[model samples]
Target: MSRVIHVFRSPDRFIAGTVGQPGDRTFYLQAIHEKRVVSVMLEKQQVQVLADRVGAMLDEVRKRFGAPIPPPADEFTDTDPLVSPVEPEFRVGTMGLGWDAEAGSVVVELLALTEGEVDESVVLGDAEEGPDALRVFLVPERAREFVARAHSIVSAGRPTCPLCGEPLDPEGHLCIRLNGYRRGVHIDPHEAPDSDDDE
Candidate 1:
């Protein structure tokens, strides 16, 4: 089948957001242009990496190409939640980022997951055959805004465990450092530990 590329050259809004609680959240990257909205699902790590890369790309563009990137702002202006419905067209498998020298814009491409291996060319190129993709181009200032919002969304997840550096669950957390003991749950010193039974 032919690839479906949703291109938002001058998006009205583009942001990263999540649904559900901290422990079980679903991360998404959404782009909007007029009434058109394109949402793609991805892991939290993907969001973090994307944000980091975009920031770095902006800096590199400024240094190498003399692009005028805006200074980092104290806070992000677009802190709103994801667009309504929150329906994701596809789960992102591979992502691509590039700086468009002519346009002085950051180009972000999110390709849909596929059963087979993906063609790298499809990432930043307009290949006739490839997985679906959502492409958004943002100017330096708007790119900075996106990076800020993405960082905030990623850090809004559950607090990490001090010992293991893993996310702590509200119900409980099993800390490997404590030899599989549940963290944050009180254990009486006098009480005997439960033993495992074998069939």
Candidate 2:
């Protein structure tokens, strides 16, 4: 089947959002242009990396190509939740980012997941045989906003364990430092542990 490419050149809204509670949340990258809405599912780590790379790419563009990249705003205006019906067209497998010098825009390409390994050449390229892709082009300011919102969404998840740097569950956290004995214990890293170190 021919691949479907959902291209949003000047999207009305493009943002990363999640559904459900913290630990059980589902991440989605949604792009909207007029009435058309394209939502793609991806992992939290992917969202982080995308935001980080986009931010870095903007900086690089400014340095190398002399692009007029804008700094992140004091506050992101689009703090609203994701659009209704939260349906995902596909789960993103491989993502591509590039700076369009002519347009002075950052291009983000999210390719759908496949059963086997994906060809690198298909990324950011016009490959007829590749998987379906969702492509969005954003100005420097919009890109910065996206990065900011993405970081906020990621950090909003479960708080991390100060000791092991892992997420702490509501019921309890099984910290590796405690050797699995203290299943439901919440210890402050600043406070000293009990004298029973022999456990």
Candidate 1 pairs with clashing backbones = none
The collision pairs in model 2 are none
Q: Which has the greatest lDDT?
A: 2
Candidate 2 residue spans exceeding 4 A from truth: 181-199
Against the unseen true structure, what C-alpha lDDT does each candidate score? 0.90, 0.91
TM-score of each candidate?
0.88, 0.89
On a 0 to 1 TM-score scale, where does candidate 2 land against the true structure? Answer: 0.89
Error of 2 at 104 (Å): 0.5
Please write out the lDDT profile of model 2 over residues 1-199, one tens digit for every residue: 8788889999988999999998999999999988999999999999999999998998888888777788755468899899989999999999999988778899999999999888999888887888999999998999999999999999999999988999999998888987887557777887966686677
Assess the local accuracy of residue 183 in candidate 2 as a C-alpha lDDT between 0 and 100. Answer: 53
Question: What is the lDDT, from 0 to 100, of the residue 5 in candidate 1?
Answer: 95
